[model samples]
Target: MCLIFRIILTAWLISSSSLSMALSIDSLRGVEKRKPNVIIIMSDDQGWGDLSMNGNPNLQTPHIDRIAKNGARFSHFYVSPVCSPTRAELLTGRYHPRAGVYSTSEGGERINLDETTMADVFKEAGYATAAFGKWHNGMQYPYHPNARGFDEFYGFCSGHWGNYFNSLLEHNGQIVQGNGFIIDDLTDKALEFIDNNQNDPFFLYLPYNTPHSPMQVPDKEWASFKDKSLIKLADARTGEEDVVFTRAALALCENIDWNVGRIQNQLKKLKLDRETIVIYLSDNGPNSSRWNGGMKGKKGSTDEGGVKSPFVIQWPGTISSGLEIDQVSGAVDLLPTLADLSGINYSIPKALDGISLKPLLVESNQKWPDRMLFSHWNGKVSVRKGRYVLDDNSKLFDLTTDPEQRVDITSQKPELTKALSMAVVDWKAEVLKDIAIDNRPFPVGHPDYKYTQLPARDAVAHGTIKRSNKYPNSSYFTNWTKNGDYISWNVDVLSEGDYAVAVYYVCPADEIGSTMQLSFEADKLDFKIAKANASGMINQQYDRVERMESYEKDFKPLKAGVIHLKKGAGELILRTTALSKTNALDFRMMMLTRESP
Candidate 1:
């Protein structure tokens, strides 16, 4: 049967069953031995130390901690250094770039639709799958969760949502305005899904966008962090903005915990608690401000602090309670582990790089294979095997002995470093081979594009930009040179035709009210002005690249417009209102595609 037909038939079955008497718990137990429902909840930019169980005295994460206390807590779990890559690995059981997701926001990088996802595996095993919260994998129709094995999808498609309250969410394929706080609304939708599917096996993937940026929280929650004078010094020393850091971050975490508590309460109310598998983890490591479990490095770096995340699994009768495992775990291992646990029968593509951890969970004494875990964010790569870790800058460390990654053993352990370096090289070669055969580029115009000879930038040297507090200013145009902006085209076209020019950019939350303009100037043509309206963080400009036939008929010499430029030199001017240091922008991309006749 066709996949769409199967989906439609499943929906019909669900509807028919809903009209009849709701299936009781006992009835569900007898019907085909219902598999345990799986719920994977992930938080964005949450630190390792953010949980109360992880030695944080200020932050109370009772709901999140309950998972650890009730089930297994992985003491040495790791994920990719950043959000998108970690998410890619979590869904595909492979490295992020191999799954077609490289950086967080670079265009054209998406979770390949052809590749199987954890949701697809569960759906094939007769489970209803729903995804809510941040769906940053891709924003296009074909790449959306609903199209990629999810029955329902409700969330933002970007990496981070600016405002915590009254956020913009996409329900299925339509954009919907949400009420109350973003996390709370997502939790409500998740609970509803769980309650509706309490009788059957279901997969709920709730990846919350919280504690990320523009940290705004409810007043009551923010009040708790106001009097913590001890944390103030630490926050100040770290150069964290107090207004946005302490108040917003604390509130965001507290809110996330509250929503988690709500989900747990719903499971109990519906008596699906024991038959549900709950997995709680963070998308990546903390970004600064709040807690970090005292590891090294921050958000984007490949250090332990950036990649090491708290992992908790809870299934009352099925999983051992309060067990702490020191074995290394990663997000990539989730798909295979879930498939094995739920009795899903399907062959994973040979491209997958993760092993099933179900053996470790079921047979406590089962020995896990000693394998190397690789992480690459942007262009930096890090490979870890047992105790040793190797990075691009030739830095190596014994994480087993030095958890903080303070002691560099590169000079002392040459043999170990060489072995790890060789492993990394081999892994990179494999990745490149996959890239070549899979027909997937990192992202259009990404700095890591194939055949590009530019040297990779050092991850450590790129300092974090401070959060802008004021609106954007037009005067800042002087700082932004035209050459610095990113531009790319599929091919050089000799034909003079109109094309669509799209520019992706990001500005501070406070600069939402400000106006920005892009002026395109070329030879003997009227300048075109494209105005930008703040949507989330970025302002998008989609305008026509017009070529007047009156100026030049033949395609001999391309007539330059105000926006279009000559081969040697051309410029586009950006203008915005005068404001304080309240705005920051990253021109993600500028693309020119031939407009259809």
Candidate 2:
């Protein structure tokens, strides 16, 4: 076994007592059939009530619903309120904060390298592992899917993408051109992986980056939902009247369902449906203004609607048809659960905020006790225990009686509130013990990522963030807004090597003489660029599009000289000392390329 796998297994064996009853390694070795192929399909922003099976009146996700109908459904499933945290929790089998992820951008999205992932366990057990679609965990090496454990990876690394049609994507470690709508293309690629690896046990994690934002869809998919009055019930519940946003949002959801249907059909055609364990769930709740099964808050909030998600586990023989498991669970449970199901003796070494749900899935009579489940975003914190929920605001809700959280019951349940509050406090403390993990550097000289592009989202801006486009994914730095302003990327020099740096920015005609200095350690390189038109430079050079609207941004470039020395970690900063005009520059990316050792 590999050293890491041995460490994970040895650590797990020492910690777990009841895993033998769940499924031991010796028992898995003696099984008659080859280990079942695992396919995990996770949508980006789907919610509990976004499906017809879960009582969403607006849309019917028949393909997604079939997985729930034929297998086990988690009625009280929970996850982090945002994309990156839930993914970190799912992959590491620990709390997001504990696993070195607390936010979507600015270096907070990277997963820690030491934590063993579900795919890592499966890969050690001889499964052909792959990850498709959205990889929001991290962009650079050691955290990328290929380095994390997957043998194959094809996806984008950002929290959300700008385009859906014919986008440039990463295949393994190389950039490749995509052919169809991103969702359809991802499904096709996943199907192809299955076709090639059918002889061996395979684990495919398909986290689609669609139905989240940009509101772009094929003409046919949008046509299906635009004219129909689909959201009267949803509107009454959400109290949203923007018809255009509603139509576009519904269109994205239905299109995702269509892609799901395509994958299900492929499995059936390949005759692999019976021998595979398929899971369908979402990273978090809905991003748009829509119905969320009457839960309290939307995405990014520490409430039921933000954290609740639909979880379905479908296996032909073992899991019964239409079984609803009401045990409270979090995304952290997924890693240990999948490892247990696969019969791999691997466990995470740190805080195991999530436990294995193997017994609960196998036996309906298994009594899994309820524990405190904490949700966090910025300064908000929420604790959920069975039907009761307590937030950072000191508001309490008995969800069994007050599902909408309309009334606060702190006065009635003083003792219970205090206990839950204390649990949340303790959990947060344990998770945040290593607060430096959130701002740790992504390695610069790794082979998987020879050139590191530090976008505006990942860089630290000393001034207030002002974007040409106010969308969350837009790139910019209005340097003139503040005196002595600068931006930098937190990065480690993974290896000593020769390098080149490319800076992406914008400068008006009058600001042609603006000078930028790229500094790291004791070395510095200066640059001065021309007054060329900055119109649509991002799309021209890198094919980046406006995330939400028609606005297209451009950037000027500078060839900053590079040097080599001892290997270590530090910040890569770009500072401007002089500008002919008020604003020195607006930046999109700063790329560092290693030439040689």
Per-candidate TM-scores read: 0.70, 0.83
Error of 2 at 379 (Å): 2.9
* Local distance difference test values of all predictions, in order: 0.64, 0.75
The lowest-lDDT stretch of 10 consecutive residues in candidate 2 is 537-546
lDDT of 1 by residue, 312-406 (tens): 99889878888878777799999988888887787766467888878767675787777888877766778878767776677898877887677
User: Mind giving the per-residue lDDT tens digits that candidate 2 earns over 223-335?
Assistant: 67767775534435445645566566667778888888887888899898888889988888777667666677777777888888889999888888888886688888888
Give residue 187's error in model 1 in angstroms: 0.4
Q: Any runs in candidate 2 off by more than 4 Å, and if so which?
A: 1-32, 234-241, 407-415, 433-439, 447-451, 461-474, 477-487, 500-566, 574-587
Measured by C-alpha RMSD in angstroms, how accurate is candidate 1? 13.2
The global Cα lDDT (0 to 1) of model 2 is 0.75
